[model samples]
Each structure stands twice: as C-alpha cells, then as structure tokens.
Target: MAMVCEGLVVDLRKLEELSCLEGRGMASHYYPPCPEADRTFGLIDHTDPGILTVLVQDNIGGLQVKSLRDECWVDVKPIPGALVVNVGDLL
Candidate 1:
C-alpha cells in the first residue's frame, strides 16, 4: 500500500522506519433515528481529499455517491461481507 501510494519501489522496512504512516487510523460512526431526518443531514455532501476510504456496511444504509454522468446522488446498497472502497481525489 505504501509503495503504491508513494510511487516508490522501496523496502517495507525502510518505509516503516521513515514513519510515513504515523497518523493512519480508522473511525466508526453511529447515527440514531431522527424524527426530523428530512430536515437535516448527518454529513453534508462533500468530496474526500485523502487517498482512500473503506466503509463497512450495516443493514441500515445511508451512503450515497454522486454520478458525474447523470449528475445525481445514487444510493449504495449493502451486500453482506462485501467492502466498499472509495477512491478519493488524492488517489
């Protein structure tokens, strides 16, 4: 992952020694049912500036991706045990 991200064919040990991946992390979010859900958004529509985003889907789905060709937001349905990878602008 580091090699591909950095565009370098270097040793893994050297990459780790450089501490290039120090702040990497994962996060989990929970949004309880809102009575006025239509009046607000948990997260505003925006673009991710990082390299990648991996999402683990729950039965209650709210993810959406905008289609450039159609110019609309499309719902992302979850498939059991399947991972959704979003390639960001940095990639």
Candidate 2:
C-alpha cells in the first residue's frame, strides 16, 4: 500500500519500510524531476508503490512515463473517465 501526491510534502519515515534503517541521501530511483523541458502545462509524473494506482487530475494535461535508459519520456496524457492501473511488487 502507498500514498501519493504530485506536490505534497512527505516524511520518508512513514513509509512501510521495505529495507532496514539507512541514512538519507539522494534516491537512486525517482519519479523524474520536473522535466527540464516541461513546465507550464500541468503534471510530469504520477507514481506510488501500492497494490494499484489511481490518478485524479485537473484539465491540465502532462502526466508522463519515462522509457528505459531515459532516452525519452512518454507523455501519458490523462483522459477523462479513464483509470490507469499498475501492479505493485507484492513479492
């Protein structure tokens, strides 16, 4: 299970904690920082670790998913009355 927010402040300590205690540092993985080439549109990414993912956005469209190697970022522009789903690593 997980909680998500595009601009909400987070306390990492509140995470379910999949690993042992470790000092804080830049996360190797991230929901790509506000794309340098993207702004003034709407969103850039939507991510969270949960059994399933749900997104609710305004008219502003910009949600995207990055490709492997990050050579490109695919725009997953949101659509009305649609739900994008993903499977979590419940392993």
By lDDT, the best candidate is: 1
TM-score to native of every candidate shown: 0.63, 0.38
Q: For residue 64, what is the lDDT in candidate 1?
A: 91
The window of 10 residues in a row where model 2 has the poorest summed lDDT is 20-29
Tens-place lDDT digits, model 1, residues 1-59: 56553555566455456664566867777676677778976578888765567877776
TM-score: which candidate is best? 1
Compared with the true structure, what per-residue lDDT tens digits does model 2 show for residues 1-91? 2343212345443344654224333323224335564453544455544434455543444567768886588877767556566543431
Regions of model 2 farther than 4 Å from truth: 1-47
How many Å off is the CA of 75 in candidate 2?
A: 0.9
Q: RMSD in Å for candidate 2, one decimal?
A: 11.6
- Candidate 1, residue 56: the lDDT equals 76
- How does candidate 1 fare on TM-score? 0.63
